[model samples]
Every structure is written in C-alpha cells, then in structure tokens.
Target: MTDRPDPFAAPFGSLFGDSMTQAELVDGTYSYSGSAQPMENFSLHPATHVLHYGSACFEGLKAHRQSNGTLALFRLDDHVERMRQSIGLLRMPVPDAALIRSLIIDAVEANADFTPDPPGSLYVRPTFIGTAPNIGAAAVPSDMGLLYVICSPVGDYFAGGIRPLTIYVETKVPRTTPQFGMVKSGANYVMALGPTLDAKRDHGADQVLFATADDITETGASNFFLIDDDRIITRQLDESFLHGVTRDSVITIAGDLGYSVEERPLSPSELADWAETGEVFLSGTAAVVAPVGTVIVEDSARTVRDGEPGPNTLRVRDALTTLLTGDADDPHGWRTTVSG
Candidate 1:
C-alpha cells in the first residue's frame, strides 16, 4: 500500500496524488493518452499564453470511498459539463465531455489508494491552460491549449471540520467582472483575492461574502444560502456568479426535505434580517454544506441565530453527506461508480 498522510492533518488541496492524466490541444484537436502518467512539472516557455494572457480554468470535484467499499465520484457529469463551459468561455476549443470524463476517471483510478475515509475523499481537479507561447496575443485567445486532471487527498475545507464559518460581508467590492462571473478561471479568483485577504486581515474572518452594492451573489469560493424552518433562500442564477453544482444539489435536497426553495436576488440588508431568525451557510464541492455562525456587515459582527450551527444546517449537511458516502439511496443518480 502507498503510504499516505492523515488527510485531516493536511490543508485542503495541499497534498496531491503521485500521478496525473493530461492532454494537449493543437490546431483545434486534443491528444490524450488513455491512462494516467507520473505527475511531473511541465517545461513551459516563459512566454506561454497562459502565463501572460491568462487563458486557464479548472474544476474541483471529489471521489468518495463509499460505505460498500467501492469508490464513487459525486456529480461527475455535472462537473465535466461545467468545465467544458469554462474552457469555452476562454475561447479555447473545448474538449468533448466524454474525453474530460475519461481523463478524470482515469486519474482517479490510478490514484485510488489516496482516497481517504468519509469526511475525507480524493479531490479531483481538472485544469486547462492555453499553451501557445505568445504574450503578444494579449487580446487574442490562444488556439493551442493543454488540459489535465490531478487528484489530491483532502479533508475539511474549513478548519475545525463541520463547524460554522464567520463571513465578512463586502457590500461595495464585487468579486469579479460581471461577464466573467460564471467562469472558473484563475483570473476570476485573483480578482477576488485582494478583497478576501483584506477581509481576513481586517476582520479575522474565514471568508468574504461579495454583496456588490447590497446585491448578494456569492462568496469568494462558495455559494451562500439562508435557511429557516420553512424556506431555503439563495441568490438566483444569473451571470453574476458561479452556478455551483453543490448549490443545485442542496436546492434539490431541500425540495425533497419539503422546504420552500426560493431563488431570487438577495441583498445585504435582507441577509441581515434573515439571519435574525434563520441560519446561513455556504455550499460548494470543497465546502460541502458548511454553516454560517456569524456574518460581519458594515463592520458589525452579527451572530447567526445564537452563534452556533443550527439544526436545519446540520440536517441539510447530513443529507448531502449520506448521499456522498453511499449510506443513503441516491435518488438523483448523482454518484458515478469507478472501477479499481
């Protein structure tokens, strides 16, 4: 057996598997080996288009070690499709969904030994970058690109595991340009980085909720939600932020749990009022379903519903957890089983 570190001791996404799968696009065609290879650094020209002009994107999803001792990937198809959309937006020739799907499965199967027990799983990252080494093509998208899938052994996204998160609400600064909100590119993330770091330094907060002039879209990394006894509310899907796969899962799960689901534009003022009676949380592949215990707005820290993880939050998190672990019936057919 390959020796592995305790996932709980490693920072999320910090420890990667030993092997990876890759492909390269040349003149609108992609060439990929049918299997995973040893993970190694790429020798890139300093003038690589992705290094300067920034044509790159990535997707994060996971493969869980199921209760039946089999490995199953959570929402694999959805993630694969979304990754295609991201590369398409970058103006690169997107690979067929089936191709990306095969790369992901192949990478995971090669490193199946790294998958950890429940609460810890193999974090799969499928990435794309424009490789045409031409910094002069700043305004023009690169035609040649590279795509690869890598795996990491990860634990909790937030420290303290399933505990609540404290968010700093920024009503002024937007996370990214409206046109690029739906893209999972490194540029989009770097645009949000300064604000996130500012929030952390200034407020000692775990994350920043980008309200953008009272318009609540999403946080830097995950989708936000407001949950009470009877209703589940979130920002409506638009081009303003990522339409998260995990967010859709929670909404579906919420509907099955019989909660009234509301998808509309939300504002910071409204979030504050909602927090008075309900619970708040962020959802994503990395975050899963993390509760919000506190939200800082206008420099005032407000505890969310007695400043603890609420019952409704736990209920939703548990529901999603069981489904991922194969302990509950997968009514949605979301789990894709992978052969060892």
Candidate 2:
C-alpha cells in the first residue's frame, strides 16, 4: 500500500503529493522534463518579473476518485485551453497544451493513491510564472517562464461542508480589468483580497460579491448565480470575472434540467430586489455550488429565501455531485478517468 499524507491534518496549500510536473520556457520554447522531485521552494531572482509586474497565470481543477474506484479529471481539456488563453493574454510564453495535459495526467497518476474518496479530491494547480529578473522593466512578452503542476489532497473548501455562505457585495471596488478578468492570473485575486477580507471582518460575511461600478461581477473566487423559481440568472461573461468551468457545467446541467439560464448584467439594486424571491449561489472548482444565505450590501443585509440553502440550489448541487462522481450518465463528456 502507498503511504499517503493525512489530509485532515494538513494545512491548506502546504502539503503536496510526492511528486510534481515541471517545465521551463526558454527562448520562446517549452521544454517539459516530465514529473520531478517535490521541492518546497522555487529558485527565482529578487527582480523576477512576476514579483514586480505580476506576469503570472494559473489554472485550478480537480481529479476525483469515483465510487467505482476510478479517478477522473473534471474538464481537463477546458482547463488547459483556459490556461493557454490566460498565458496568451498575459503575453507570457505558452506551454504546449498536449504536453501540459500529459504532465497533469502523469502527476495525478503518480499520486493516484493519495487522492481521497468522495467529498475530497486531488486539487491540481497548474501555474505559470514569469521568471525573467528585470525590476526596472516589464517582461517584453515574458521571455522566461516556468510552468509547474502541483497536486494536493483537499477536503471541502468550506469549513461547514455544503452550508449556505453569506456574501458581502462591494459596489465600489472592481474585481479585475475588463480585458483581463476572464484570465486566471494571481493579480486578479490579489486585487479582490482587500474587499473580501473587509467583508469577512466587518460584516461577518463568507465572501465578497465584487460589483464593478455597481454592476455585479462575481464573488471573490467563484462565479455568482441566482436561481429563481422559473429561471436562473447570472452575470454575463465579460472582461471582469473568470469564466468558471464549474459555472459552465452548472449552467449546462441547469439547462438540461429545464431551467432557463440567463446571462446578463446584474446590478446591485437588481440583486437586492431579486433576493426576495431568488436563490443565490457561488460556483467554482473549489466550492462547487455553494448557496448564498445572505448578501450584505453596504449597511443592509438582504436575506435570500430566509437565509438558507434553497431547494433549487440543493437540487442542482446534488445533480452536479452525481454527475461528477460518475453516478449519472455524463452527456458533456467532462470526466477523464486517471490510471494508477
């Protein structure tokens, strides 16, 4: 039997699996060296471009251990494509998609025994950082880059499991730039951290709903969705928030379940008005589908359906969980089984 780390005792983002995949971008070419020995620290100069200018991009996805004892990756190809797009948008050298995919599969397979069962997954983080050391200047198209994939066995992201989360809506601060919002880069989250922390500290909220100039964008790390009795409404995908893969999956599954999914601009006023009748939730790879109990907007806290996880939210989450674990027929073909 393979020795696995005690996930329950491991600190967040600290305990990684036995090995990781490393690749280097040199002279505009990517050289993948397959899986490598686990290293706790990275060697980079003090003037690394990523440290100063934030030329970094990343992708987050999971490999789940199904009931049938098979390990499957949730939408691996889509994540790879998204990572490629993020690199392109950041003007960083892009890694080969096929190579990256292979690296991910290999890393997961290498650490397959470490993946926890249901309610836990192998959290895969594929990161690209600009390694060029030039403090006075920004990397001109990011000449040097490092691409590495790390896996961690994580349980539920939310401490209380699938309970409804309280979110605070920020009408002043924007989540990210219009053009770069869709990209998975560290800068975007950094921009949102202050507001989120304030929300948690001041309002006792779980997350922040980042509204750009009064227009609702997204929650801190996930896409926001509102479910009415008849239809589902979410903010339209633009340049400000991430196009979450889990959001896409939820929308598709909701559509298949006969719910009309509407993508449009959602204002804070509209959200306040809609909160009376609609159910709100945040969707992401980490949180999956986390229902919103209340949204603290400014001084007033608006409750969504008595501040509880609504029936619709629970139903969708159940459906998604079933689909993800291979209990349901996967029509979208998102699952990729991994071999140990």
Candidate 3:
C-alpha cells in the first residue's frame, strides 16, 4: 500500500484520512453499515434540502494519544449529547445517543494509526444533513438523512506556539439567534462569518467577540473567559451562545486549583474594568485556552493584564493538558480509551 500523506501539514479540511464511517436514515429509522472507504467527493442532488434549506449540523472533538500508547477521547459523551440536541432542534432524524457514540469511536479507532501525539491530535467531525431534493417546501421533516464521521490529524492551530490574540468586541451584530445559539448547527457559524470577516479586515483582529444587545456572548467559535489573580469569571450559560465542553473542563480544573469561579453576564463596558485587574482567555475544543492580549472596542483598545498569557491562564492550560495526556489523575473521568 502506498503511504498516506501527512494530514497535519495539509490545510484544514483538504486532507482527510483513508476511511470514514457512514450511516443513513430512511422512513424515520437509521441503518448504519459501512466501512472506512477512501476519502472522495460526495454525491448529492442539486436541490438537496441541506443545500436549499440549510438542514445540517456538526460536532468537533479530538482524540489524544496518551504517553502510554493508548488513545483516549476527551469528553466524547458530552459531544455526542450535544449533537443529539442539535439534531432534535433541527428536526432531523438521527440515531440514538449510544449509536452516535459508537460511530464516533469506531471511526476514530479505524484511523488510529493517524492519531498524532502530544500537541497534535486526530480531529473528529460528525456531520448530519438532509438529503431529500425537495426544495420548494422544506417545512415537512426530511425523510432522508446522512450521518458520517471524518478524521484528520491536525497540528497546533497557531504554528508559532501559544501567544496572546487580538479580538474585536462587536456590539451591533449578534453572533446568532438566541434559540439556535446553543445548538452546534452550521447556520450559527454561518451567521457570524460575514461580521467576523469584516472584523478581521477592518480592525486586524483574529476573532470577533460577539455581544448581545446588552451582554457579551462569545468569540467566533469559542467561549470567552476572564482570569484574575484569584477568580475566573465568564458569561453564565443561557440561550445566547454554545456551552462548550472545553469551557466546562477549564472551569472544573480551575476550581480544583483553589480559584473562585463565577458565571455571569459580561458587558462591553466592563472590558476596561476587567482588563485593569485581570487576564482574559478564549476556551474551546480547537483553542483549548487561548489567551487574549488585546480587546478592541470600536476604535479604542484595551490591553489585558501585562499584555501576555497570564500565569493563571498558563497554569490552567497545563493542568488540563496533563489530565488529557494521562500524566495527572483524571478525577472527572472525561477521557475514553479507544481500542486499536
């Protein structure tokens, strides 16, 4: 067999693994029976419901290869549960929670040899979409649906190592609708793409801090957090943004390290006040815990504490990494070992 190209060196989504797991829904029931076939183009009709009505959702999580040569998925159950919730909200027929988890684990194990070590991981993407070609009226629930999980070995998101990022605090444009914000649906991210692109172009920012009319929501794809000398504060969970699994992991780890944790509504005006005395960071699956060095509010800017990755941010990130790699005791039982 020919050697597979290094997915880590390829651009995002361009290089997929050799195989994938697929399932289909027909007449309101799911039938899963497929192997990891070669990655290739998908066949879909021109008027597919997903193309016209945007009936699709997806989840992102990683599988880490531990130092002991064993692979474990971080918060796999949480991700499966969130995907189920998204399917329900989107009115798409999907498999049970157990089936979804099995699909994800099986796909990861099938591509075990591609799971990179340490800072690199096998990124798993599970997507669901309506395939029926009736675009005139999509109010009727889709009779057909497709579910699949694709794996890719991804390197560090920032090639230059961990550094503070500059973010634009946007108040006028909302990230997404309040009802759909919590769901891991494609439409949610689609809504923020335009504004985020504008922020990057006009303000030279890395991400957009989407805020509600009165409260701050989240960045483009990650949740936001503030780290002070003794406390960690973030926006309380509501219908305005995604409740990230990584965010929960960070909060739990921080609390264990003797830092006070508070979840409340954060406003744009409070950025200067918080920056005066604390450090800020973004938390998510891809980012883990990315420090925020600067926050640009309209034309004015405020530098985070010391304008660098705060000691507390680094501490929490290290703690989480240790737990994920099996160096530290996983008190939360978040990791699931995948059989090769």
Candidate 4:
C-alpha cells in the first residue's frame, strides 16, 4: 500500500486494485471460479465481436471506506440490475443478478486493502464484452461473452475537488441513438467525443450538455438537474439518456428535505430562464453531485446565479455524503457492507 501512488494525487481511474473477478459465457452458459483472481490483461482475437460490432457495456459504482472503519457498496443491487438491463439490450444472454452481486462482493473484499479514505473510494467497474471472434456477425448477437468486475482507487472524477462547472449547450448534435440511449455502452460515449472535444477546445467547457433541437437530455456522462429553494426539475426518463443512480439518490434526499421533484421535458429556453434564478447541477456514480455555474447556449454564455455553489445544492450534497460514509442512518437501505 505504501508503494502505490496516492489515488487523490493521481488521475482518476488510473490506480487499480490488485484483484478482480470474472466469468465467461459459452454456448449460452456461464462459468465463474467463485473467487477472486489476480488482475491481468486479457487476450482477445483481432476479429472479436466487441471489436467490430460494438457489443460491450459496463456499470460504474463505488465502495466507500466508511467513517466507522468498514467498507460498504453504495446502491449495489440497483447497479447490478442496470447492468443486466444493458446486457439484455445488447442482445446477449444476461447473467443472473445473484452471480453479478457475488462477483462484485468478491472483487471488493479481495481488494479491501486498497480502499482509500473518505472523499476517495474504491471505484468498481463491472464490464461485459462479446468475444465470439466473428467480424461477419454484425447482426447476430455473440454466443460468447466475458463479464468481469475490477476496482480502481479513485478520488474525484473532476479535478480540483468539488467546484462549479462550465457546461456548453449543444443543440445540433444528439448524444446517441434515441432507443439505445439507456444502455451504458462505450459506443454511446464515443458518439459524444467529437462535440465534447470541440467544446473543450473552442468554448473551454467542462462538459457538453446535449439538447438536440432545444430538447434537453443530459451531459456526456451524467444526468442534468434544475434545483431551487422550493423544487427540483429534470428531464423525465425515456430512451434518450442514462438514468443515473446518484440522480435518483438526489431526488429522494431532496424530497426528504421537502423539495418537490419534477421529472418532465426540459427545453433550452427553459434552462436559460431557470439559470436566471435557480441552480443547476449534474449527478452520476463518478460525480456524486456537481454544481453548474455557467452554461453556453450558442454564442451566449449565461452564469447560474452568481456562479457559485448554492446552499440547497450543498445541503443535498452533504446529506448524500453523510449517508454514503455511514455517519447517518440508512433509511432507504441503499448501502451494502462488504466483509473486510
């Protein structure tokens, strides 16, 4: 542990744990070792299905080293269910929920020595890829696949800790295909790369908010939100974007704090109007709750209410943090403790 680089100082997701768990699917059946194994590179054929056909997806969640000297996985079951949904959508045979849960637990517990302190956590990545070695089967789902869970000791997804972000509104380019938007696939991420890089180079933005003809969807990697003194508003769930776990947690905690949660269609005009008074933020597994201070719509850049982290935003953030670190009671049963 002393020889490893500090996760806080290093780039996020660069420092990995020593152990991992994996399973293989062949001929419509799955096989796992029922234990953790040493982390290593995988050998794949040049014509692997995922390489040419894009038959891959993944889920991101965290295992926090709690205030009480224990480690717990946040929203573990929900992530498992979402990963299964993603696999099913990829036209592959989905692994049972129990198998996925056990794999995560085994991987986390095996790497418990690598767990960092609060404000830093063990970022767990459960990935699935097709390995059928068939470049000709673009329309056919792979009969062979690999499912694995690995851990990375991470600090912050965005650098400089938690601060307000600058978002660029993209009204012309859609993030991904509408029907497949809900899947957590790398293809969806690659679709946003061109616009995101352009925004960074031209507008100096932190992330690109895809509106696609004034219909607000989400940022590249997180869910969007509009927060104020009384209510919280966001785009209702459909097939247009990823439904975030932290987004759900925020809505639940905000409701517990008496803020009205409204899930509906949000437009760029409505966002510009809300930025005049209300607060805005992004939520995700990697980014717990990120405050937005500025938004660039076309040629105009609008600041969100003095361009600082608002009180309500901080309040919700604090509550979620407390619950995550085990300082508060688990009323919703969101945390699952893993054995050290």
Candidate 5:
C-alpha cells in the first residue's frame, strides 16, 4: 500500500489496482488470454455502438481481507449471473459465467496486495461494452464487444462511515424506465441523475427515493427497507426495480435470525406511517445496510423514529459484516476464496 493515497482519504472507487483482465467478443465468439495484465485504457472508435446506442452494463462486488489474512469474494456466483443477465438485456454477446468468474478471481488475486483492512476492501467492477463502430445501428445489437474486470481499494461508499442518511422522496419522478429498471445498465443510472441532483441541491438530501404513482420502488442505487421488532418488509420483485443481492442477503439473514420477511408493494404514505413507529433502511452492494434518518416528502421533512440508527438495522448490518470478513461461519456458502 506504499506510494499510494489512503483509500479512506480519497473518494470511493477513485483508486484502482495494478492489473486487469479483458476478453474481446468478435462476431459471436469470445477470446481471452486467461490471465490478468497491466491496467491500461482502451482505444475506442468515435462511432462505437456503446457510445451512441447505450449498449453497456456493469456489476459491482467486493473482495474482503478476512481476519485470517486471506481475501474472499462475497456472493461471487450471484454477481456473475446478474452481470450475464445485464449483458443479455443489452443485446450484446454475453460471455459464459465461468469466464466472468475466472476473470474476476484472477483480477482479485493479482491485486490481493492492495486489499485494505476490515473497514476497507477491494471493490471489483466487471464492465461490458459494445465495440462495433456503427452509429447507424440504433435498432440493432452490436456483434463486437469488450468485457473486462478491474479492482479498486475502497474505504466506504458513503462519505461518512456507518451513519444515518437523509433521503428525499420523489413521487412524480421514477428512478428509471419501468421496463428496463431491472437491468444493471448505465442508461438506467443516467435517467435518475436529474432527480437525485435536484434532491441533493434543493432539499439537502443524500439520495432520492423514487416512488412513481405512489408506489415505492427504490433509491437511485439501492433498495428500500422497513424494519421493526418482529418483521422485515421490502418491495416485491418486479421489472420496475432492481433485485439487489444485498437485499436478498438481508432478508434471508433476518428470517434466519427470527424476523418475519414480507415482500410486497410499499408506498410513501405507508412509509411515513412506519417512520413514526418502525425503522427504515437501504441496502445494496455499495451500501451494505444504511439507516434512514430523515425523509423529505413533498417538501415536508419527516424524521424516522428518533432519527438515528436503530437496533435491528445495526444487528443485521453487523451480521452481514461478520460474514463478509470471515469472522462468522459460512452456512450459506456465499464466499469465494481467491488464491494466487
């Protein structure tokens, strides 16, 4: 870690590892060297398909430095499957799951020396982009693509660590188009930029919680949650929002820890009511489990009960952290060990 800026001092995802693995898709076949090489930039044509047609998608996961001095990737297979789904959705040449998994592992192993301590980890990003130099093919899928994996040593996704966040609720604007919400594509994120920026500028919000037509879906980059002493509730899975891996992990862990899990439609009215009596949180790969302190609804600010991190939120977060760091038993078999 010498001769490098501290990850905690720099912004998350700003620092990169020394190596990367890349594979190219031509016609319908894929080719790779089966190992990581020196990290560098790619030279793409000005009229690349992805530049104009938005044929790009990405996945975010992490590799943790365990207590026993080894690195492990959490929910590696699930991330791989989701990335494949995203690529297929973009109408690009989807790579095999095994190839994606091997590339990720090899990249992680090549950068294993950069993995930070417990509070920090190596953020792994697998990206795919259409490479055909065709700006006219707006209605057609590109036949050539590039798939690559990179790693970044990150401290925390949020600026401050483990504190409650303030979110603004936008009932009129959605995070993204309903039909394409489930895909992990860059277009989906760009669509939410306006609302998120407006919320942050006008309402002093950390993020925007999008709930079009009074139906709550998710924040810009994470899933919403409502928790109490006996039950954990979130929105039902659909094509309207992302199905998060961290969200699934939280539900499963909570159910095993004796809380009733409910997946159904949630609304802002119900959330306001729950804020008076329950706890609210958000979950994602970047934000493992983030407590919601205040929600600005229709220009009216409402504080969650006591406006602080609740016990149940911390309990689940601690459990997830322990599992990620190999401090607890892997009963779910979700961790993948990456070795050189």
Candidate 6:
C-alpha cells in the first residue's frame, strides 16, 4: 500500500492497490496479457463513445482477508455475471464469463497484500467503457471497448460504521429510469446523485429511498428491506432495481437463521407502519447489510425500532460477514479463495 492514512480513516475506495488487470475488445474479439499489470491510466480519444454517449458500466465486489489469513472473494461468479449483464445492456460485447472471472482473480492476486483486516477488505471494481471514438454514434453502441479491473483497500462503505442510517423517502423522483435499474451502469448512479445530494442537504439523511408514486423500490445505492424477529420483506425482483448479490446472500442467511423471507412489492404506507414495528435495513455489494434508523416520509421522520441497530439486523450482518471471512462454513459455495 502507498503511504497514506489508513483506509479505515479515509473515505471508502480512496486507496487503490498497486496492480490491476485489463483487457480490450475490438472487432468483437477480446484480448488480454493474461495477468495483472501495474495500475495505470488510459489514453482515450476526445470523442470516445463512452465519454459522449455514456456506453459504460461497472461492478463492485470485494476480496476479504479471511480468518485463516488467506484472501477470498465473496460471490465472485455472481458479480462476474452481473458485470456481463451490465456490459450487454450497454450494447458492448460481453466478455466470456471465464475471462471476466480471470481478470478479477488476477487483480486480487496481484494486490493481495493490500487486503485489510476484518471489517476491511480490498474493494474490487470491474469497469467497461466503449472506446470507439465516434461522437456521431450517439444513438449507436460502440464497436470497440475496454474492460479493466481495479482494487481498492476499503473499510466501512457508509461513513458511520454499522450505525443505523437515516434514510430520506423520496416518493417523487425515481432512482433511475425504470427499465435500466438492474444494470450496473454509471449513468444510473449519476441520475440518482442529484436526489441523494438534495436529501443529504435538506434532511440530513444518509440515503434516499426512491418510493415513486408511493411504490417502494430501493435506495440510491442499496436494496431496502423491512425485517423483524419473524420475517424479512423486500421488493421482489423486477426491472425496477438492482438485484444485489448481498441481497440474495442476506435472504439465504435469513432463511438459514429461521426467518421467513418475503419478496414482494412494498409501499410507502406499509413502510410508515413497518417503521414502528420492524427494523429497516439496506443491502448491496458495498453496503453489505446496513440498518436504517429513520425514514423521512413526507418530510416527517419515522424512527425504526427505537432508532438503533436492531439485534436481527446485526445478526444478519454478522452472518454475512462470517461467510465472507470464512469464520463460518461456506454452505452456499459463495467464497472463491484467491491464491497468491
């Protein structure tokens, strides 16, 4: 690692590993050097299609420094698959799954030393951009692309570690265009930034829950959930939000830990009531399992379960962490051990 403040002390993803992996797609064929290379910048043309037409996408996953003193990537295959989907949606040629998997693995292996202790890990970001220089191709996808994987040593993604987050319920603006919600495109995040910033500035909230038309979907960055001692309820899989890998893990863990998991449409009205009786949370690759303390509905704050991290929320986060760190059995075959 470079000489800098601890990753835990810095904002998440501020410190990157020294090595990275990259590949290029041209004329529908992808090629690579077959290993992680020194991290570097790209020389792109002024008219790069991604810069003009927004043909770019990315995926976020992590490599944990496990309890056994080894590095293991959590849900590597799943993230690879999601990245492929994102690339395809951007009209870029999707690299073969094995190739994407190899790029991520090699990047983590090359930068394994930067993997931090428990509660911190190497954040893996795989990005793809349309490299064809054609400003006129605004309505068309680029023929050439660049795909790369980078690693950043990161601590808690949220500024406050494991603390209950205050969420602003935005029943007005949607998080993204409904059809493109599941694709991990940079455009989607940019679209949500205005509302997220407004929420933070106006309501002092950590995230904005997009519940357009009183129909609940997800936060700007994470999947929202309502849970208690008995059931875990979240919006069902649809074309309206990202289907998070961590969200799936939490559901499986919730079932394993004896909570009935419910995947269905949630509403703002229901959330208003659930806030009093249930614990609210958010899940994603970055957020992992995060508890929500307050939801600002119609500019009024509603406290969720005494405005603190509930036992069940902590249980879910701990179970997911243990699985990621190999402190517990990996029954679901989720962790991929990265060899040095």
Task: Compose the digit string of candidate 1's lDDT tens values, residues 1-340.
Answer: 3466788898898998899999989999999979899999999989999999889999999999999999999999999999999999998898999999999999999999899898899999999999988979999989788899999999998978888788999988899999999999999899999999999999989999998878999999999999999999999999879999999999999999999999999988888787788999999999999999999988998889898899998999999999999999999999999976
TM-score for each prediction?
0.99, 0.95, 0.96, 0.99, 0.99, 0.98
Q: Which lDDT value does model 6 have at 279?
A: 94
Off by over 4 Å in 3: 1-8
How far is 79's C-alpha from truth in model 1 (Å)? Answer: 0.5
Q: Which stretches of candidate 1 lie over 4 Å from their true place?
A: none
Q: How much is the lDDT of residue 54 in candidate 6?
A: 89
Better of 1 and 4 by lDDT: 4
Least well predicted 10-residue stretch by lDDT in candidate 6: 1-10
- Winning model by lDDT: 4
Candidate 4 backbone clash number: 0
- Candidate 6 lDDT, tens digit per residue, 1-340? 5665598998998889899999999999999999888998889999999998889899999999889888999999999999998888787788999999999999999999888898899999999999999999988899999999999999999986888899999988999998899899989999999999999999999999999988898898899889999999988998888988988999999999999999988888899999887899999888999999999999999999799999999999999999988999999999999885
Question: What is the alpha-carbon lDDT for the whole of candidate 6?
Answer: 0.91
The lDDT of each candidate is: 0.93, 0.85, 0.85, 0.94, 0.93, 0.91
lDDT of 4 by residue, 15-126 (tens): 9999999999999888999999999999999999999999999999999989989999999999999999999999899899999999999999999989889899999999
Global CA lDDT computed for model 5: 0.93
lDDT (Cα, 0-100) at 179 in candidate 4: 86
Residue 32 lDDT, candidate 2, scale 0-100: 81
Count of clashing residue pairs in every prediction:
0, 1, 0, 0, 0, 0
Model 2 steric clash pairs: 178-239
Residue ranges of candidate 6 with Cα displaced over 4 Å: 1-4
Tens-digit lDDT track of model 2 for 1-340: 1466666556545567878887888898988876655645787899898989899899999998887889999999999999999999998766778988987898888877778777788899988998888887663755788888889888788876888788888888787777888889898888888888888899998898888678888887898998976789888887667889999999999999999999988888888887898899999999999999888776699998788899999899999998878888889999999896
Model 3 per-residue lDDT tens digits across residues 169-277: 9888898988988889888888999999998899888899997685888998899998877999889998778989999999999999999999998888887678876
Candidate 2 least-lDDT 10 residues: 1-10
Residue 218's C-alpha lDDT in candidate 3? 92
